[model samples]
Each structure stands twice: as C-alpha cells, then as structure tokens.
Target: MTSPAEHPSAESPAPVRWGILATGDIAHSFARDLALVDGAVLHAVGSRSLPPARAFAEQYADEKASPVPYGSYAELLADGDVDVVYVATPHGRHTEDVLACFEAGKAVLCEKALTLDAPSARLLVDEARRRGLFFAEAMWMRTNPNIRRLRAMAADGACGTVTHVRADLGFVAPRDKARLWDPALGASALLDVGIYPLTFAYLILGRPVEVRAVATLSDLGVDLAGGATLRFDGGAIASISWTQTGWPDTRASVAGDGGRLELPSPFHHPQSFTYARNWEADEIAEPLIGAGYAHEIIEVGRCLREGLTESPLLPLDETVDILAIMDEIREQVGATTG
Candidate 1:
C-alpha cells in the first residue's frame, strides 16, 4: 500500500501524542476524531480548571490510553510526552496560547483564522519558522479528501478555465452565544463562516488582484452578514457571502467555460460534488473518516513522523495570506476591534 506522503521510512514511527489546549466544543470534535487517526494518541488535555479538563479526558478515554488532564495550559505544555499541541481556544486567545506552546518547545496545530489580525499571525508563523517547530492552521476544509480532489481537478483544467464561483453560508445565530456576536471574542460571521467559502475559492483561483466587499455590521460593530467579489487573474471572479442573520442555502458552485461543479449545502464539509460538462454529469463521493476531522489529524501525524515543521498541503504562508485577506475585508467593512 502506498503511504500518504511517501516521506517517512518504510517503517512507521511511534504514535504522535496530541495535547489539546482548552476543552471547548471544537476540541471535543478533534479529540473524538483522533480515534480515527492510525498513529495518534490523545496524551493530554488542558483547561482553565481541573474539573472540566478531567471531565473531557474521562469522556474521551479509551482502552489504549487516557489523556492526562491539566488544570492550566502551562501544565499541559510542560508535559514531556506531548509531541504536539492543538490550540482550540477562540480567535482572540490563539496568539497567546500558541506562543506559549512554542515557548515550551512543543509543536502546534492552531485553529483557523490563526489570529485576529495579520501581523499577529505573521509573528506566530515567524516564531515557528525560527524555532523549527511543526505549526499549521487547522483549516480542516483544506485537508478534506473531496476538497483536495476538487482543487487538483480544477488545477488540471477539469473545469476548463474556471471563470466564476459562488458560495454562501449562514444561519440565525442565537444572541445568547456571546462568541457569535461578541467582538471581544473575535466574533463575526465573516471570520467564522466566510473563511470556508473564501478559502475554497482561493484554492481554485489563487490570490485575487482586487477584492470588493461590503458588510452589514452588528450593533456591536462585528459583521453579522457580508459579501465579497474577488477578481483573479484572467478575470476569474468569485462571489462569496456569509451571515449570522438568517438561513441561506449554504451551497457552493464553480463555473468554467467547459463545465461547472456543485457542492451540496454545508459545502465546507461536503459529502460529494457533482460536475456537469455538456450532456454528461458525474457526482463524485469521497469517503471521510470519523466526523471528517480525521484527515487533518492524520496529516498532522504524518508530518510529525516525517519530522517536518509544516504541512505541504496547507502551508503557513497560505494561512497568513488568507488571514491578510480577511484583515483587508474587515477593514473595508469597518469592523471594529471590539
């Protein structure tokens, strides 16, 4: 059987121990998916307090291993067995937490939108580069099998000079969820949901020469809903939208002179994609592991086994570039720091 990257020796390395910081909802999902990764162990978990940390560890414990629960992030970072740390904190706390991981000489897989601003994201990237540590933005979509196939097909001209793309994601977010509306939490539909569609477009068309965007800001100054029109080379354009206001179809499609492809609702984690050319159409299904989060965990494990500092599939520079684009979009929409 062919290895994922063919970089590691014929013999597999020891299991990669993952240390998770913050027992938030995202961390729960990541931990559960760790079970699906062939060579990964949930060695440790940390939270602000011992109770929640212990609870999370108990819930995800398996016959093979039970993750050590730490009451503080520093305690987890200090653990010698932790090969890497997954920072699941909110956008605002990412920089501080990730930098702490680096200080402890631990590798890191930080959540998407690496930081609230471009400069901070760059700082983290520079630190990882300088330290020669493994680091990646956990933009899980980019690691999806179907999305990877789509990107490859588009690049190979399966869609023939792709000229336009359309994608939107939205839902009526509950006001009680402070993270969805609180600017202090780095809350914004654009940051939370818009990044998916925007990254999808970027994977296909690369960087755009011009981006014209506008948004409807919440009373608190975060963007509740917005849209952006990006113009890429050869005049390819992508129309993207997101909202915390109401339900949207959440569908995405890409068009080219030769054909077009459509992804179902919640396209970011789509189960399949359909491509139509002339009189024929084909729907492609790519099997997903666990809750579809396994792919990323597997990628991280592969990188560690290979002793690589970053993933080739989702480079650090790409993460910084995407964050820079969001920074510009936020500025154009007049989003506040909150």
Candidate 2:
C-alpha cells in the first residue's frame, strides 16, 4: 500500500489515535488514508448499526491492532483511548453528531459545510471554543498540496489579477431512497456536491458580497441541478453549478487579467492544472501517495503535535462562513431544509 512521504530524521514520533464516527463509503475511504500515515492508528469505529462497525474495524486494523467497534456513536466518544473523531454522516446529521462529540470532550474533524445552516455551525464553533478542543470542517481539498500551490501562485499574481472563477462537480445517480437523492436526507446539489466547486472559489476569493442562485427542483422538491453566481468586493465573480441528474464536466477554471488556469478533472482532487498565458501553456501535477486524504490526516497530526486547536490553512471561521453562504443560496433558490 502507498504510504506518506517518509521523514527519515524524525525522532520520538507519536501515533494519532483515531475514532471514526461513521461506517459509510467516505468514512471507509478516510480510514484507508489514515492507515497509510505512519503515526496513525484506527482505535475505534462507530455506526448506527453494529455489523458494519465490526466489518470496518476488521478491514482497516492491523493483525495485532485490535480496534473496537461501537454500535452507537456515544460509546465511541466515551472511549478514553480515542484522541480524535472524524464525523462522516450526512450533512444534516453533522450538527447533532458534532455537538455530541464536543460534549464528550473529544477533538473533532467534521465533514464540510460544517452544519445545515449558519446558526447550527455557530453552535459547534462555540462549543469547541468553550471546551478548548480542536475542531475543523473536513474541507479536504483545501489541505491538498497541489491546491495549496495553485492558491499560492494565484496570490503571487501568477494567475494575474484574478477576475473570474468557474467550476462544477456532478455525478449521475438514481433517485432512490439513497441519501444523495432523498430530501429527508438533506440531499441537494449544493450541499451534497456543489460545495466542492463553491469551496474552490471561497478558498481562492473569500466570501462574496452578493449571491444569486436558481435550480430545477426534483419530484421530492430538492434541487436536481442548479447554478449559482457570487459577486465579490473587487469586481471578481465566481460561477458554480452542480447536479445529480447529469454527469458534470468535473472541471474548474480561473481567469485573470493576464492568464487562466484550468483543471481537467475534479477540482477537488485534481491531477493536473494547466497554466496558460499569452497563448503558451504548461501543466503541473501532484500525484497522491494513497488516496488524497493522507495529506489531511498528516495535517491533523501535525496540528495536534504542535498544540494547535485549529489549522490556519483550513480555519474554523472559514467553515462557518461557507455554511452561511450555503444557507443563503438555499434560501434564495427556494430549497428549504424542512
């Protein structure tokens, strides 16, 4: 299996004990990434169901590593062995699950959008602050090296004076009772997948001053597909769209006064980005050792060792800000949470 970039001269390496808070596909992917980092261990797994939890532990744990499986999330939180918890439930469940973890006095890395709305997100941030525990939204793409490099280049004027951004993320899926299509599951293009491209813009340009959105509502009254535009303070604008009804182009581009950069694949896990200026072009790629999540796991470990509660790279404030933007977009487009 692929592993993290080794640090040969390092001494006294400490292992990060992880307690996974869900057993879904994303949770499994994260668990796989965690196992690739040298100083990381899967200490426990939790699910609303017991069988899946045990299966997860068996699949990720080493032969001598006996990771516990908890039927309920509370039991996992109560375990003194777990140093941190990674919450991977659906978007709506994030508010309650994260709050519960904070109440348990455990450090948390909750999934993106942070919560269903701004108010719920505020509660998590306040709770984490009150308990003095580390908390962050799992905006995994923000911590990606290639993405960081791209942002740095943009900041340094390599992409010129950023004038506009366009991005999209979509995948075709059936409209069954699956979480991605169910209104009861809080499924919508914006939250379920739109956040990827939306976040790309947010990471590069910060929050917009004005937001406008429109969507094609599904039979369940959820957004089947939608497009949104954000206008920033400096005349910069971002156009973003997402859909479950159709396959997305899955690409992103940023245009500036001098040049433009384009990613051929998903902006979130981009393999290559092309830099073009004056009719000339060059490509840059940063390959992952495992799945792209290893870097984020490494990041969390670094922050913990350095005694930091939040990472400057992916701050808690940014999480709350993005959720607020999402909430407003939903309201403007007539996508109600209830």
Candidate 3:
C-alpha cells in the first residue's frame, strides 16, 4: 500500500490532470476536495453553456493551478491534456457521458448509482474493462479511513457472527427540485439517496439472494420514499430505507450473536462508530481526515499510477451488483425512470 503522501514523488511525475464533465453543485464539492489532494489537478470543467463553467472555474481557481472552462462537454472530452474525467452529470445522463469519456480514452470516476438501470451500468463497466481504463463508482463513503477500519473489524470477526444490518438515509428535498421530481432526469429516492444504505449492506453482507421492496411515488411517477429488505445466502439480512420527502434518523447498525456496531448519524461519511463485544464496554473507533472525497480521489490516482483498471476497494463487479439491486427495487415499487 503506497502512503497517500508518497504520491507525486520528488521526481515530479505530472499530476493526474482531471476534467470535470458537469458544473453542478456536486461537481463543485468534488473540485474543492480535489484541491486537497497532492497528486490530482482540476484541469478543466465543462457544461452545456460556457457561463456556468467559467463561474465554476473562477470559484475554484488557485494561483498555482487554474482550470480551463469548456463551453461543451464534447470539447472537454477532446482535450488531450486531461488524463481522467469525473462524470458528475445527472443520473439520466450518466450512461452517455461515461461512454463518451471512455471512447475518448479517459479514465473515469463516475458518481454513485452509476446509471439509471442495470443494463446501462453493465455496459459502462464492461466497456471500461474491455478498454483497460480506470473506472469506479464515486461512492466516497467506501474510501473513508474510518469506514475502512470498520470493514476490517467485521472481517476479523470482531462482531462475531454477523446476523443483521439496518441502515437509513433521508432528507427533505424541496418539492420543486427538478432532479428529485423529474422522471426524465432519473429522479427517484432510491437512486439519489438510498444507494448509500444499499452499498453499506452489500459491503457487509455481499450480494443478497432475495430482495423485497415497496415505495411511495410522487405526482411525476418517481419514488419519493422507499424501503427494502434483503436476504443473503449466508443467512444474513439487511433492512434499508430512504426518502426525499422527509428527514429520517440517518443512522446505521450491524448486529451479530456477540454484539453490535453503531454508526452515527449521516452514516455514509461517519468519522467514528461504536463497537461493542458481548458484555464488554463499548469502544469508539475514530479515524479522522479531510472531507471524505479526498480518500476516493487519492485511490483513483493510486490505481491510475499503478496501471490498474479498477479499484480493489470498490470494484466494478460490486458496483454492477449494487445497481442490479436498485433495479429490482425500482420494478417492485413501480417507479418509472422514463
């Protein structure tokens, strides 16, 4: 394992030049975190129009590194200087955007949910593999140091025989938000926010053998809230839920015969978690770091430098499985992505 600090050595290998594919709010957050990474550079930002791209570049500009702004995504993809592209477009646009980047021979770190459906997700993953390019779903939680520690503990049997996992994430998204209510944009609570809890369960329990789910739909025929119960072949079970119409506890827990581990609120990016073993006193595990995005950014840079096509931490196979689960849930709930 290369130390995070060991990136961009004294020999001064050029930093991994990044081209961002959208100028949305999430793109801004990712750009802010990219500045914190030692071996990553925000080389350019693209939007359907040039004004937003210019404004985003101006907001994140640094004296030593200023990103160029492209008026169109195609222009950004054609840039020879960009080594990798971050696809931060809406969920509905992910498939086309990712394929475009892959065709351009650029490595990609696409945002979570990867795509609106399993077939699309598979296409992205398979294409990236065939081309031998670095590709990963940007599930930043999986890259957090503390989450890594928790995963290690589970694997070491610190929680005894894992029996159950429960996780939930929700927030009151405004009714007028186009991304949440518009079906054309792939609007659905399950894809937008539920993915975190689903990913958490998959990390601990692997792929489920059966999935049962239900959901509430908005006027636009998109899911506003939903829950799913997953049963794994190993006799482990996970209950997960999410909503865009209300804020829920947002906490998570994993239980076993011996004890349980409790993740604090906003479980997705937890800085610490409580571990209890049988009758022993509860122990706190806290491994702090900068805003969570840097971890994944660092991992992407590491894999690219190592000539790897996928991250061992968040493999493409696992991403496809997660999306498949979401696809099933969508069918059960009658949420239409069209």
RMSD of each: 3.7, 4.4, 3.6
Q: How many clashes would you count in candidate 2?
A: 0
Higher-lDDT candidate of 1 and 3: 1
Residue pairs of candidate 2 with colliding backbone atoms: none
The top-ranked prediction according to lDDT is: 1
Off by over 4 Å in 3: 1-12, 279-286
TM-score of 2: 0.93
Model 3 lDDT, residue 111, Cα: 92
Q: lDDT order of candidates, best first?
A: 1, 3, 2
State model 1's lDDT: 0.87
Tens digit of per-residue lDDT, candidate 2, span 1-338:
00122211135454777899998878988988887887778889999888999988889878535689999898998987787889998887998899888777788888776777788888889888887778888888988878887888888898789999999999886656477777777877788788898899997899999999988887777877889999998999999999888887889988899898887777888766899999899998877657688888888878776667788977888888888888888888788564
Instruction: Write one digit per residue (lDDT tens) for candidate 1, span 1-338.
Output: 11123323327666778899999889999988997787788999999999999999999999756999999999998887788889999888999999999898888899877888889999999999998888999999988898888778888888898999998998999878888888998898888889988998898889989999999997889999999999998999999999999899999988999998888888988888998899999999899887778898888877877778899987999888998899899999998754
lDDT per model vs. reference: 0.87, 0.82, 0.87
What lDDT score goes with residue 254 in model 1? 87
